[model samples]
Target: MAEWEDGFWSSKDGLRLHYRDYPAKAGSTRPPIICLPGLTRNARDFAPLADRLAGDWRLIVVELRGRGDSERAKDPLSYVPVTYLEDVTALIAEAGLDRFVLFGTSLGGILSMLISATMPGRVAGLLLNDIGPAIDPAGLVRIRGYVGRGGSYPTWLHAARSLAEVHAVAYPDYTLDDWLGMAKRLYRLTPAGRIVADYDSAIAEPFKVPGNESAGDLWPLAEALKPIPALLVRGGLSDIVSAGTADRMQAELPLLERVDLPRIGHAPTLFEPECEAAIDRLLARVGRAG
Candidate 1:
């Protein structure tokens, strides 16, 4: 049940944003699920999940700026989540979609929550893969180290191998090719011909700068999805979104249902039968209303 899914458009900044969609190919029944990938991820990562769910709800995955086949921004500051929301709004309009479901993971989840708050009317429902309002500082530091690292990897194999270790909690079984595909989507071949990461290197500017002392809070955004049907899926061992926070989220918004996958961390890849079935239930619950 892991397999198929494209909608490609140029952003206002002139970077091509690659979106892979299942569309309403034959079933003209419902709007599609807009798949928002994680940081350093591309649309292709959703291929397996998209193909598996095509028989039910349609799936559309977007390659965010500086990731996947999408072009990197000239202004590194543009890589922020706020910029991402505007870009997604553009894509939604370009797709000719008035309203649709949002399936977001990690960074994508953050954007989904924000968009749900800013453009509630546009999102039919919000599917959060493995993220929440409170993020673990330890995990943020880990991510910062890699995203902020410099220099080219000797080869894709080396890069992939390194990720498998660093991401062992989230991607324990990822194959060499899986890692390679990941590397491809997150980086592009530089003009000098070497494979540099798919970002303006400068994109990490704000993130690297000295901390603006404020406890980050996304509950406002998460709570905004309250009226709209929503589902939160978390990995059991995830450092990013712990069970404690997920529980608190459920309590705050009783309407927002929650589930946790065992033995995974950061995010679940969403290819397992249990995970798939759980998602289908959530989508059906929301999609059936419209």
Candidate 2:
């Protein structure tokens, strides 16, 4: 297994944030990849991807405030995308990243688009996993139904079974072991010895406010990818990113490559062989662009 150093940085508001820093191979000149996870996910979500690609290019898997080892926000409303952008900006400066690639999943993908737009010429390559400017309403409804509903399980198997029950539609092919792995990634053992979701449940407060459920008008932000090397990974069964949205994105960004994982749902693990191959191709393009 590839090793990584635990990294910590302070957000603008003095909240402590965490990330995993994986070193690049000796003599490697490829731009480092900054990974951002989904709304409810943490840095552990990217462990598999980092294990595979870290040696070729450095990978910084970030744990946004209120998730994983990061400090929870004192104000629940601070859990907005704008706030996350600020946190990522701090990470960029703290890491002294001049130029880098972004590998964003879901909410992370939205952040990648925002970063590209706000910091032009800094993002060399973009990889958006299972997200687009316009999200499907069905997906939004499904997500809203469970965002802040916290649960506790007495054992890891119990937690895994619970997740399988709730998310079976999104991952129909997942075996018990797969669900167990996902449970570990998404939950943590508490001091009392019960398993619970790793993120701050209050992070869902923003969703309570009407019209804040989704980021409004991301198409302009998506436009930022037009001049850069980009890749979009969409799950064919995804309720979040529809086929139409992915097609529109491709039409808008002629340089963007779109990969559809037929067996997947709202998100591709990026551990999928097809996703890995597509990412390799995108990095090759980035290398040639240099």
Candidate 3:
């Protein structure tokens, strides 16, 4: 396994957040990748992918506020993307990083666009996994149903089984070991030996409010990445990003490269061969290769 160290930085709002920093091979000069996970996901979501790339380039996987080891916001309303962008900027400053590539999944992908828009030249490259300017309403509805629904299980096996029941559609070929790995990524064991979702249930408050999901189109923010090296990875079975939207995105940003994982849904785990190949191409565009 690739080695990594725990890192912490404070958000502008004084929230202490956590991240995992994996160093590159000695003397390697490739630009680092700052991974941002999906809503309700944390740094652990990138473990498999990070380990795969750590030998060639540095990796910094962050746990957004209210998720994983990061401090939970006292106010559930603080879970919005704007605050997340602020926290990311703070991370850049605290980490003393000049420029880095971005690897974001779902909500993290949305944040990548916004951050790129705000600071165009600072992002050397962008990889948006299973998200785009347009999000399918059906997927939003499905995700909303479970994002904040927390549960406790008697053992790790039970937690893994529960997770598989909820997400089996996305990974039909997943074996027991696969489900077990996913359980570790999404849940944590408490001192009392109860296994529960790692994120704060309050993180779902924004989805409950009216008009929040369709506030506006993200195309404008995504447009900011036009001048930078970028790639979009979509799950062939994903409902979050429809074929129509992906087609339109390519039309708008002709320079944007793309990949589709046929067996995955909602999101493509970056560990997939196709996703990894696309990432290599994206990094090569920025003069970094694995």
Candidate 4:
């Protein structure tokens, strides 16, 4: 098992945030890789990937406020992406990270772009998993349908079944065992012994406001990635980042390395063999650039 230390830091507004700090191997000079998960996900989502890459390069897997061991925000409305950017900015300063690679999935990918745009030269490389500047409306509608709703399951099996019902389209090859493992990552045991979604349901409140569904004019943000070594992993079955959008992203950012996972859905687990290889290639390019 890859070992990591549980780390905590305070957000600018005083919310206690958490992350898993996996140190690099002794004497390694590789830039640390900072990971950010999807909107409803937490640091646990990166455990498998961390297990594979931890010692070669430092890994910082963050849990945004209201998710994982992080303190819930007093005001649910604070769950917006800009607020998340503020929290991550504080973390960068707290960890004293001068330059690093960004690995973001969905919402995390958006954050990575924002960080690179704002910080300019600090980001060494980027790995955007299953997201782009243009998000499909169908995907947005599907996500909104479940984001804030709450549910409790009597057992892990039940929870897995529930998720399989909703997401099987995205992971058609997932076995019962696979679903079970995913359930553990996505839900947590309650004091009452019931299994429930790990995040605060109120994180979904912002989606309720009209016109917030679209992320609005992100093409300019994509420009920030043009000069850096970047990788885009797109699931062929993904409803979020369509083929058209991915093509445009590559056309605009000529240096991007694009990998299409035909069997996957909205996001690639990064555990996939193809994803692992692509990431290694991107990091090598970063190493050469440095």
- Local distance difference test values of all predictions, in order: 0.76, 0.92, 0.88, 0.93
Per-residue lDDT for 152-260 in model 4, tens only?
Answer: 9999999999999999999999999999999999899999999999999999998988878788778899778899899999999999999999999999997799999
| TM-scores of the models, in the order given | 0.85, 0.98, 0.95, 0.98
List ranges where model 3 is wrong by over 4 Å: 288-290
Relative to the true structure, candidate 1 reaches a TM of: 0.85
lDDT score for residue 86 of model 3? 93
Which is the better candidate, 3 or 4, if ranked by TM-score? 4
Error of 2 at 170 (Å): 0.7
Best by lDDT: 4
Cα displacement (Å) at residue 245, model 2: 0.6
Across residues 97-180, which tens digit of lDDT does each residue of candidate 3 receive? 888899999999998888889887888888999999989998988898888988899899999999889888888888999899
Off by over 4 Å in 4: none
For candidate 3, give the lDDT of residue 252: 85
The candidate 1 region of ten consecutive residues with least summed lDDT is 206-215
Q: Each model's RMSD to truth, in Å?
A: 3.2, 1.0, 1.7, 0.9
Clashes of 3: 0
